[model samples]
Target: MKIYVVGIGAGSADGMTFEARNVLEKADVIVGYTVYAELVKKLFPEKEYFVSAMKQEAERCRKAVEMAADGRNVAVVCSGDAGVYGMASLVYEIAASYENVEVSVVAGVSAMLSGGALVGAPLGHDFAVISLSDLLTPWEKIEKRLECASAADFAICLYNPSSKKRHDYLMRACDIMLKHKNADTVCAVAKNIGRDGEEYAIMSLAELRNYSADMFTTVFIGNSMTKNIGGKMVTPRGYKNV
Candidate 1:
């Protein structure tokens, strides 16, 4: 009756936490988005699996809960930190309706954290995580958040930057940010972090509008004081400068 919700850490098998991997090895059934399921196929080659595409999130979590309700150990996998825009919340929603189902969450490295590590400590201070996907949230709300994050000078990490259906949102977001930040503000687009086709580039807020971003990309925009040194992007914590 235990359901382990494991954050698979940006779809990198190597990024899987030791505890998450142990749970995966013992799980009788695994459930996740189709792309995430495929990314971890090697770990659960012999286990029962359920994969769902976009917008079928509720159904996928229900299936996992059903299996767990039947006394099977299930692992619900999610890319990045499960709690941050991952399956953890959806799983909790379904778990609320059930009784006697033990649910545990295992943390993994999220793309935002990985991307921050790749650059410098842009996140050493306060930061905000935002998703540009308007499919679930209103565009006005997303825009408002972007404006607030920029105004606060909080380092921003963006997930689900762009897709075939929603291509111009990131550009639009940058345009809004420019009002609060300078043109020289450092930014990074970390694509497919820790996975194949992984690519990342550092640029300025002004240049962000020119890039072709995709769903796999995690964008990091520096604060007002962030700077680039020797090709590495860094947001100093004042200790170094003091």
Candidate 2:
């Protein structure tokens, strides 16, 4: 039995990769978080689905693996690239016990890519993608990463910027980065990326520290050379020739 871990990408057909779409289409069952389940149900309403709540990743993967072993073609769906903070790794870990099951991963555009496009090319040079949520990682570890990425001059992309309970996580991260980065360093926030109500704003690192954000927002802090070129948040690649 084989199972596909598919990245749905921004919860839209336009954002999903062709291979991801094909895998989902050919699968007999689709499994994912509740939000992702709803997103794909619109594209493939005829298929059966199994949805789990947030923080239920282990149980979710177990359910998907079980279905695949039952002679069902199962597709475990996730938003953005399956390998990037998605369920692909968990699936592999859980599927190791079942020698009969095969796992395949289908990649798609991650929020870093989709959201970066919305605000121009904030990732034109080296960059780092870090999640502000300490759900699985400790806050101290997250702080060290932010400080190091900033000191290394990598444009930084942030995920899970904020939630009701962790409202100040993004701001705290900014404070850490600011210790290495400039207060005037360029930054941007892209919300609802590749979906309705899509919007983005370019601002200074100082301004972003006070900016309101949510779980749906993807934050981008530029390297020292980043600039606001005609309303675009671009990090120059230093071509010299332009």
Candidate 3:
């Protein structure tokens, strides 16, 4: 039994890579969060589907494994890069718990990458990806990582920025970043990147503090070198000297 954990990249069919599309086309069943399941359903109208709510990681992986054990070619769908804050780890964990269930991860463009592209090359150099969600991790730990990343001057791509229950975390994170970075530091928030309702707003760090953000938003905090040009955000790769 084999399962392909494929990242669909922000739930846009156009965002799916060629390899990922091929894997999905060959899959006997598709398993994923409800949103992702709906996105891919039209493509595989005849294929069987297994869906779980958004945050049901353990149950989702267990279901995938169970289906695979029944000799189904299941494709566990994820938004953004499966390996980047997606279902890849959960699938691997469940596979490791059992034996003989073959699992493969098909990478997709992460929110960091897709959102960065929407706002020019904000991640032209070294960067760190962080999630603001404290459900599984402590807020103290999340804050520590943000502080460390800031001190290191690394470009930061933030995931799970704001949610219904966790409303003020994004603003708090912006305050922390402002303490370490200048007010003029470039910052951008991309909402629903590569999907419907897609939009991006580029601004300075100070401005970002008051910017409207939601759980669908991916925030990019630039390094000292980042800049905004012609309404597009960019972090120069430093090839000019060469």
Candidate 4:
């Protein structure tokens, strides 16, 4: 009974890691959020798929564990790295009760990495990855993280920046960062990364506050040392003058 937690990477087959593809191909059952499952389906349509709605992560992982315990090789798929705000932890938690199941995690390119590439090397130095979704986390905690990351001058990558229910969350997050960062600090929004209609834009912290983002958008806020080099957002790693 082996269960693989696979990261599919940015909703495109091109972005998937070799290890992730291999695990998905070998699995008898594929389980994930409906959107993620559909992405995997495009690559491996013959495999059995089990999909659930949003906010059903626990239920989904438990079902995957059950299927694994039934002697089926199962792969629980997620967009981006499964360990990063994905289904890996929940799968492991559920598999703990199933003594016969062995769990393996396959890494994939996360949005921060993919989005960063689209906008040059904005994350060349120290950075923080935070999620603005307050469903599982408290708003105060997210605000505090934004404040701390901004104050520390770390480039910040934000996941789940906005959704229909949380329309103003990204703006509020920007306000927090503005408290510590200059208005002209470089910032960017990477939308639909690796998928169709992919678009990205570079701007200042002040401009980003007025921008609109959705669930598919990943936001990047550059640190104090960041700058626009030839129209690309870049952060210096202090390797010069060596």
Candidate 5:
């Protein structure tokens, strides 16, 4: 029995990788978060689905593993690359306790990459990805990471920027970044990437501090070397000087 932990990409079938689609097609069961499951449901409605609400990650993975151990091929889906804050690790951890269950991870485009393309190439140079959700990680640790990334002038990609309960979290992060970056630093936000009503905006760090975002938004803050090129956010890789 084998389980495929697949990355469905940024909430659209067009964004899914060929390998990921094939895995899902061959799997006997599909398990994922409620929102992710819904997205895949439209693509592969014939497959059996096991959907769970948020914060039930452990239960979801356990169910996938149990089904796989019963000699059924299973696919556990996650938005974005499975290795990045997805179900791949959890599935592996749980599958370790079960015998005869193989695990295969299929990668896909993450929000940072998809969002970056929509707003130009702000991540051409070295960058950092940070999640603003403090559910599993402490706020202090996130603050330190933001500070370090800012001081190093790394282009930053933020995920899970805000939700109803944490509306001010993105603003707080912007404030921390302001201390290390200039007020005019180029920033961008991509909403509903690769899906309907997709929209993006480029602005300054000062303007971004007051910007509103939701769980579906991805934020990008450029480094000191970033600039606006033809109204697009861009960070040079310095290949021109070579």
Candidate 6:
């Protein structure tokens, strides 16, 4: 049996890659976390769904792998690319014990790419993607990554910037970046990318320090080379000088 770990980009039918859509369509069962399952249900209602709540990732992957070993085509869905903070790796880890199941990953667009375009092209050059969520990782590591990314002058994309429990996480992140980045450095936020009521906020690092952000927002911090082109956040790759 083939088990496909799929990334349904941006939680929108329009945002899904053709390969991702095709795999979902071919699967007999779809398994995912509740929130991600809801997104897939809208696009493929006919398929049988097996959903679990958050923080039950291990059990969820085990169940999906067990089902696949029973000779059924199963697809496990994630919000963005399956490998990027997604269930792709976990699925493989669980599937290891079950030799009968074959696993394949179907990639999808991640928020960094989608959000990067929404606020122009902050990702035009090299960049680092970091998640501020301390659920699995410690905050100290997050701080170290921010400092390194900032000092290296790499355009940075941050995920899970803030939430009810992390109301000031974004602000703290900005403060760390500010140690190496300038106050005037351009920064932007892409809120609810590719979904309804989507919006963006572009500002300097100083303004971003006090900005209100949430889990739905993807934050961007530009390097020294990044600037505003018109009203959009942009980081040039030196094409004009060539």
lDDT of each: 0.86, 0.93, 0.87, 0.92, 0.94, 0.91
Which 10-residue span in candidate 1 carries the lowest summed lDDT? 233-242
Off by over 4 Å in 5: 239-242
**Higher-ranked by lDDT: 2 or 3:** 2
- The lDDT, on a scale of 0 to 1, for candidate 4 is 0.92
Worst 10 residues of 2 by lDDT: 233-242
> Per-residue lDDT of 17-106 in model 6, one digit per residue for the tens?
999988988999999999889988988888899999988998999999999999889999998789999999999999988978888999
| Model 2 Cα RMSD, 1 decimal | 1.0
Q: Candidate 1's residue-wise lDDT over 1-242, tens digit each?
A: 78888899876777888898898899888899898898878776888888999789889999999889999999999888888888888888898888978789999898889878776666766788999999889999999999999998988889888999989988999999899989889998888788888777889988987788988888889887787877667877753574
TM-score of each: 0.96, 0.98, 0.96, 0.97, 0.97, 0.96
Clashing pairs in 6: none
RMSD of 6: 1.4
* Tens digit per residue, CA lDDT, model 4, 107-127: 989999999999999899999
Q: Which ten residues in a row have the lowest lDDT in candidate 5?
A: 233-242
Show where candidate 3 strays beyond 4 Å. 239-242
Which portions of model 4 show Cα errors greater than 4 Å? 239-242
RMSD of each: 1.4, 1.0, 1.4, 1.1, 1.2, 1.4
Q: State the lDDT of candidate 3 residue by residue for 1-242, as single tens digits.
A: 78899998877778889999999999988999898899899677888898988878889889898888888888999988889888888888888866779889999999898898898889998888999999999999999899999888888999998888988898899888777889889999898787789999889998988876888899999998888888777877764632
lDDT tens readout by residue for model 5, 195-218: 888999999999999999999999
After TM-score superposition, what is the CA distance of residue 178 in candidate 1 from its true location, in Å?
0.6
